[model samples]
Target: MKIDTLQHTSHRTNLAQNIARVILGGFLVMAGTSHLSWSRAEFLAQVPSWLPIDADLVVILSGVVEIILGLSLLFFTSRRRQVGWVVAAFFVLIFPGNISQYMNGIDAFGLDTDRARAIRLVFQPVLVLLALWSTGAWQAWRKQQSGD
Candidate 1:
């Protein structure tokens, strides 16, 4: 099936959505900074042992990506939908790391218990949904799918 290049173009976000987007962006920027700096070691605990890449390298690269995605969300008005999709996918891509943390019972970011880690896992989808909803990506895709 052919994909429409324009299918994920951005739409105007209302005040609440815009606020949420900005907050999410700020959160990403902070987390990314932590990955590159003080929290680098903490983030390492999340890297799955089976991943062939050097764990440090993975952390560093993901940090960079998070920063870029965060900045895009903060400033890319005409392309927020695209950025939202990318951000959502980024969350999904990194989900395995969270799973690894849980499976290994690795404690980091104050998640010292299995219960805490499991709860953190639950928030991953919330972040994904926030990216979609705050940027209007979810609505845009639904409209397209329904042929509206």
Candidate 2:
């Protein structure tokens, strides 16, 4: 059995993917923390009445989940695909929150308009892509991870 230099190159590529995961994970943690720091009333106002939980609790819990998922990515590099799955789940779960924010005219870090809020919605998939990229799924699947 002969292992060519290509194997070493692929190994390095995987290592780069792992590093990207850590960077993205740290970024997500910081973003989630910012949400946590938001005024509870402001966030509460954004939550729709249809959701079961209190608005304040929902806002806080969402931040906690984001932070946890982000941190998990850093520590669970070997399970990149599994982490991606979890992250995708989080994205789906929080999507309603994003919609609520948009509909309620909530200013998320001063993003006030529905258009601004709606534009922000596009990034959710990009975050998922970052997660999937960490798993090298895009490489295997031949899909554009980011719209750009």
Candidate 3:
């Protein structure tokens, strides 16, 4: 009975994780689409002013990259661990943009106030955690660290 319970719990966990992964992928794709389309200006507001590249070009390229990452997350089950790591890194990499938005008081995505922007920044880490946990990347990393 205990073994059966364990198996059931494991299955439920996997199902939840897969659902979360799909949701995150869909969200990324939608955001990416927005970056290239109606919300281009809004995305530009998030780009750090100190970045040397043209903001529009950066937004466009990041949009393309986001689409690719989202597709990989949704379809590349065999490489999910790697994808998760990359996704987490991508989140980390883009964090400076969020900080820039807050520090510069650039309003975008309904985050008009400094407090709102600061709150938005808090979610980036959650995204990183989501990317890692939903794909079991965190567990894999732990196992590797312990040399299991």
Candidate 4:
């Protein structure tokens, strides 16, 4: 009876975590799409001048990648490992843009305050968590630990 109670609790927790992941993944996907549309110029302008690629192309390409990551998070279980890798890669790739924004003091969507900029820098890790949660990697790790 106690074992059954623990199992039920675990199942409920997993379901809740999965729901949170879906919501977070959906928000990220939508946010990325909105960035592609409403803020393309502003985001492009944030691109560091030193970066060789034209800002316009960079914005479009980044938008495409975000969309891909977002969709992968939402679906595609067969490629779960691949998706996890891609999300991690995407997080790494876009971090420079975050840095560029801080260094250049670039403003987008009217986020110009220093406090806001600091918050921006601090937000990257949350993206990885969201990605991992969406991929169920966090749950897998927890389960593996429990088995051991």
lDDT of 1: 0.91
lDDT tens string, model 2, 52-118?
A: 8777788788778878888888776555565766787777777777787888777865678888999
Please list the residue runs of candidate 2 whose C-alpha ends up more than 4 Å from where it truly belongs after superposition.
Answer: 1-16, 38-42, 137-148
TM-score of each candidate? 0.93, 0.71, 0.89, 0.76
Q: Number of the top candidate by TM-score?
A: 1
Cα displacement (Å) at residue 106, model 3: 0.9
Q: Give model 4's TM-score versus the native structure.
A: 0.76
Best-first order by TM-score: 1, 3, 4, 2
Evaluate residue 108 in candidate 2 and report its C-alpha lDDT on the 0 to 100 scale. Answer: 63
Cα misplacement distance, residue 20 of candidate 2 (Å): 3.3
Off by over 4 Å in 4: 1-13, 138-148
lDDT of 1 by residue, 36-89 (tens): 999999999999999999999999999999999999999986788888999999
- How far residue 111's Cα lies from its native spot in candidate 3, in Å, is 0.5
| TM-score comparison, 2 vs 4, better candidate | 4
CA lDDT of each prediction against the hidden true structure: 0.91, 0.70, 0.86, 0.69
Question: Which candidate, 1 or 3, would have the higher TM-score against the true structure?
Answer: 1
Q: lDDT by residue for model 4 over 1-148, one digit each (tens)?
A: 2332222223222566567656765765876786679877787867788899888888888777777777776676545544665786788788888888887788875769767877988988787776666566655556655863
Cα displacement (Å) at residue 144, model 4: 7.2
